[model samples]
Target chain A: MAEIRLEQVRKAYGGVVAVHGVDLTIRDGEFVVFLGPSGCGKSTTLRMIAGLEEVTSGTIRIGARDVTELEPKDRNIAMVFQNYALYPHKTIYDNLAFGLRMRKMDPAEIDVRVKKAARMLGLEDFLARKPKQLSGGQMQRVALGRALVREPDVFLLDEPLSNLDAKLRVRMREEIARLHQDVGTSMVYVTHDQVEAMTLANRIVIMRDGHVQQIGAPLEVYDRPANLFVAGFIGSPEMNLIEGRIEGADFVAGNLRVALPPGVQASGEVVLGIRPEHLALTTEADGVAFTVRVIEQLGAQTLCVGEAGGERMRILVDRVDSWSPGQSVGVRFPAAKLHLFAKSSGQRVETAKP
Target chain B: MSSKATIYGFLFVGLAVTLALIVAPAVYAVSLSFYQMDSFVGAPKWVGFANYVAVLQAPEFWRALLNGAIYALGSIVFQVILGIGFALVLNEAFPGRNLVRGLSILPYLLPTVVVILTFKWMVDGGIGIVTKAVEAMGLPPINWFESPGAAMASTILVSVWMWTPFVTTCFLAALQTVPQSLYEAARVDGTTAVQRFFHITLPMLKPILTVVVLLRAIWMFNKFDVIWLLTRGGPVGATENLAILSYRHAFNLFDIGGGAAIATISFALLSVAVLIYFWVFPLEDD
Candidate 1:
């Protein structure tokens, strides 16, 4: 196992840059996920690390050796592509043993490693079957098994579960997490799905337009996002970012006036961010006047999406079946949970954490 | 009910065309093989397989059959091998790739007679480019259509040149259907470019390759025009394949029944060969 390091890695296709200078170090046994939307260069960065895409400028190292110039085969890494990319003609056994066979390992040892990976991936019964004979989930496992048999220094996965059905994706996601735990090898995963990043990654590197937004643990980024994009992107019911101005210890936007957190440093135009779950429904007389437009009952939590002082806001609260559309209700934004960002730069304006 | 009627109507038309154009001619030819006739207008007398027995007894018939096999096998082998090589080169990203691909298909697009005439012009004695170059290199001028071996080689070379573009186009289109991820996966799996071609590219192309080879084999075995135009079965019956032999028996010798017998035998041989080829390399994905 080895740590993968990228120092100012960049990728450009002619004049257009796909990945800007990205400097990141994935520690040994760490599960780092590059999370971003489509065309945001998350997959490009992972491909660069895997040696599948050439780094236009800068260095990448696997362990202590520079691997940016080496071929993928010489980088001591295995990748599971989004489409599973299994050898369709080969049986599962051959697909798993192909790498070892290419490396000219002993035939007996290749058999041993292949069988071991198959058993671990619950693919022993599928050894004689071709890729077409297997289900989407089974093919995904075979893809994972193919990488496992290589026993490389690092594992790179490019949205490996994106092709499976929803339920299968969840099951395969669990299987991947379990595989990582069992192998204890460094892994670099790329996905546009925030849920996958939040659930599986030890550290989530959020990106936008080829620039890193924030890199932190799941809850850390959720609790304290570094920028407006990160704040809005990291949450399920996206965080409400209201365009407003900070004036005299209060945020003012149209007729809405909410007292700002104490010791706020910014003074000009600012964007206030607050998560849905951080708000609460109170008596009409207790908090700000909120008119509920729609109510979504989500098992234990009822999400109230409506206008709070003429600004769109979503308030998630414990089951409140009493609420309905066009109902007059009061919602309170806990001061401690309120986040603020500079509107000009879109960077977070640090406030005291409660 | 309307859709069903439409399907049946289309099937009836297709069956009618097949019977009229293909089956009818085949049946007429087979029936002709069992009769004795000097010309199409002459009274054909029922010979009851006498023409087949007489043709089988002739040494030229056996030699023509052997020559046909050699020509077909040689042309198909070279065409397919060179076609695949050119397809691989054309598949790669290059500056003028589209232009090159268009030019590569030029040979296949040309009329067969035009291509044959061009080949004849290129290898012409005294003034042809090939003859001039051979003389410049102090090598003996090639007797392209004089010697038996040279005549056979010339025909094979012309056939390969005229038809390799068709094979390359088919293989090139097949190469496009392969997913790019498969090659990346192979590279990650520690395969060099050669290994990747053999393991991934070749296997991915198998289904198309099977069909292409079978089509090329059948066409080359029965190919008549290119050889007829280039060598006309040679100086000493060297390039006289079954097709040429059959044509000569009918037109030149005025032995219509003998020509039909050879044609029937050639058709039967091809049918059996096709069945065996499919048995060895079935087109369906396993």
Candidate 2:
């Protein structure tokens, strides 16, 4: 078990930088997920940590060793790739035992570890079978077992569940969590799916366009996103970001005005942010006017999409009444739930009044 | 019904060409083994298995068969080795890689006669650069074709030089299909470059390698032009293979039945060898 430290790690392909300088330290045994959309350098950063991609600048440390120039094998880290990347020609047993055998471990010990990993992954019956004979989930388990047998200092997974079907992805996600808990080894997972990051990570490092937007606990980032991107990216159905300006302690857009939260300082242009679940249905006179354009019944909660104060907004409510398009209603944005960001910079503005 | 018609139409064309060009000539040759004739239009006498027995009993026939095996095996071994080496070099990322890849296929693109003559020119006793290089290196001037060993070596050398590019191209294409992640996984699995090649690259290439070797073997076994143009089965038939022996018996010696019998035997042997090869290295993985 070792903590990983990335100090100002940068990756550039010619003049096109893939990953801008990223600095973060992963605590020992921590499950840190690098979360981002495609081409956001999350995978590139994970690859650099795995030593599969050469870092353009900065150093990578696993534990106390400066493994910046070391080969991946020498760094004592095992990686599971997006496609599983299991040796197709080899049997499941051989695939699991490959790393151990390469390290010149004892035959008995390698066999023991292979058996244990197979049992852990429920692949004991498939030891002699090649990768093609297995399903997608089984193949990914073999990939995980391959990493498990090595007992490496850290585990790097690059979208390990992306190829699996939805139901299988959930099962594998739980399996990975169980594996991590059982072994207590540090794992660095990369994915574009924020749900996977939120569900699987002890800490989620959210990135955009090669720059890290925020790094915190799943709900910590969900509750308090550092920037506009994180605020929209971390939640389901997205947060409502209404463009407006602050004047006389109220956020005003067109003819609509709402009392701002206390301690608002130096905010002329601001983007009012609130989640769909935070809006409450109230009397039309006491709240912002909302024209319902589409109503989607989401089983327990109904999601209503419409315009509020001349800005498109989504509000979620547990309602039994059937709603249709063109219906006007009033939705109140709770003060504590309202998130405010600087319109020009997209950074969160301090809401506490002096 | 239209798709069915299209499929049948394509199949019929292919079958007609195969039967007319390949099956007919092969059947005619085999049938000639049963007859004794001085010329194609002469009064032919039925010989049955007499020609086969006579050809099989000849020492030159056996020697030619052995020479063919040696030539095919030697050429294939060197071709596969050098082909893989060249392919591995070409597969790496380098400047001018496409230009080098295009240039590498030059020897294979040349006609057989041109390549043979070029080989001859390069090893000529007086004006050859190879001879001059050997002399400059203070090495004994080697006989390229006068001796039996040198003659056989020269034929195999020229064949490998002319055809290694084809094998290299096949291997290079196969190498590209190997997913780069497998190599990266191997690297992370604690493998050096050589280990990765053996563990991942070679296994992934097995199916293609099997087919390529079989093709090169069959073609080299029946090859007549390169040896004929270079040595002409000379130096007391040192480089003579089954094809050369069959040609000599039919054209030079006018033993048509004997030539046909030799050709028939070579065909049967090759079919048996191919059967054995498939049995040993089946293409489909279990």
Candidate 3:
């Protein structure tokens, strides 16, 4: 296991910079994820750490050695790409043994490590089959097996499970989590999927436009987002942000007023950030009014889509919540679950009043 | 149901007509090869293996066949290697790359007759630029097309130059279809540029290269115009190829049976090569 440190790392393609100057430290054995939207430079950052991409102007120290100028093989890192990137011509056995064989390990030792990885990934039966014969999930396992056989200091996965179907993505996601627990090696995963980041990462590094928006444990980042970007990106259904004036201890938008916590420091206009499940439903008299547009009954929970201040808003609720389209209902936040940010900067504004 | 049957019947007839249009000439040639041209006025009489016997016994026919093989194999080996190399170079981004690619295909587009005549004039005996260049280098002037070995070398050289561009074009088109992600994967696996070519690019190019090489081989084996124009089977039949020999037999010697026999033999050789190619690399398997 090795710690990774990026010091003022920047990557530019021509005059257009893909990765801005960023600094991060990943402790040994930490499963850190660089999560962002598409076109964000999360993959670029992970590739830099793997030495697949040249560092424009910074040092990438993997475990204590500066690998900024090293080749990918010299850096001793293995990466699982978004497409699995398995050699289509080689059998699963050959694919898993390729890195070990490249390192010139003894033949018997190579066989042993490959078998162990295959057994761990449950790929013993498919060892002799080419990648074309295997399903996407099986190919992903071989890719992971290829990395595992290397026993590299850092494991870099570039959205390895994104190619699988929905059910398979979940199963493979859990398989990755299990693999992490079993190996305990440092892993840096990059993905546009928040659910994968939320579940798979021991520490999440939320990035946007190549900048590290926030880095902390999944729940830590989810519970205390650094900015409006983090607030909206980490949660499914997304954190609902309503722009309005924070007049004293209450945030008002048009005719809707959701009271904020006491001593809230925002004056004029500010954005109200609340998770969908945190939007509590009540009788018409108790809270801010909501007219439901669509109700998605997801068995245990329902997502209510409605219009508020000319923008569509989503509210997650238990499936038993009774509401209909065009019906006015009161929505409230329990103060402790609510977040308030500055109107312009999007920085969090702490408060104690509601 | 009656209308559908009529449509199907009409489609079958059309297909048969198309097949017959191609097969009739070949069938007639085979029939002609079985005869002896005893007289020019009457239809040739059946000779029963006499034409094949005469062709096998003739030293000129045997020499031409050997020269053709040398030309075909030599052209094939050089074309595939240099074409793949040139294709790799063109696949990358270089200054004036579009112009470089366009110019590489220039030799392929030139008329075969013009190309042959130009090279002939440039390499003709003493006044020829090629001979003069050799003499200037303090070496004895050599009669290239007048000697068997030199003629075969010239034919192979010109064939490689003319056809390698075709293979290069094919390889470049195939290279474009290779997913960039595959290369990135190779790079992350610590594959160097040379290793990536062998491990990733080459295997991915297997299907296209098969088609390209097969076509080039068949075309080179059947090629007539350039060889005929330059050598004309001169220097005591030293460079007589199947195409020129067949033409000389039917038109010059008026030996229609022998000409037909030579054509059949060439066709058989080509058919066997194509059959072996399919047996080795099936399109459906990949």
Against the true structure, candidate 1 reaches a TM-score of 0.98
Docking quality category of candidate 1 according to DockQ thresholds:
high
> Candidate 3, residues B1-286: lDDT per residue as tens digits?
9999999999999989977886787898888899988445777798978999999899888888877777778899999999999999999999999999999999999998878877777888857899889989999877787677788788788888888898899999999988777787677666778888988899988898888888887887787887788777766776667888998998799899999999999899889989999999887444
Interface RMSD of 2: 1.2
- Estimate the overall C-alpha local distance difference test score of candidate 1: 0.92
When superposed on Cα atoms, how far off is each prediction in RMSD? 1.3, 1.5, 2.4
lDDT of 3 at A270: 84
Leading candidate by lDDT: 2
Q: List, residue by residue over A259-317, the lDDT tens digit for candidate 1.
A: 87789898989999989998877886888888889899999998888988889888888
- What is candidate 2's lDDT per residue for B147-189, written digit by digit as tens? 9999999999999999999999999999999989999999999
Once fitted onto the true fold, the runs of candidate 1 whose alpha carbons sit more than 4 angstroms away are: B1-11
Segments in model 3 whose C-alpha atoms lie over 4 Å from true places = A307-312, A352-354, B1-20, B38-41, B125-132
Model 2, position B185, has a per-residue lDDT of 92
The per-prediction tally of clashing pairs is 0, 3, 7
True contacts kept of each: 0.83, 0.76, 0.43
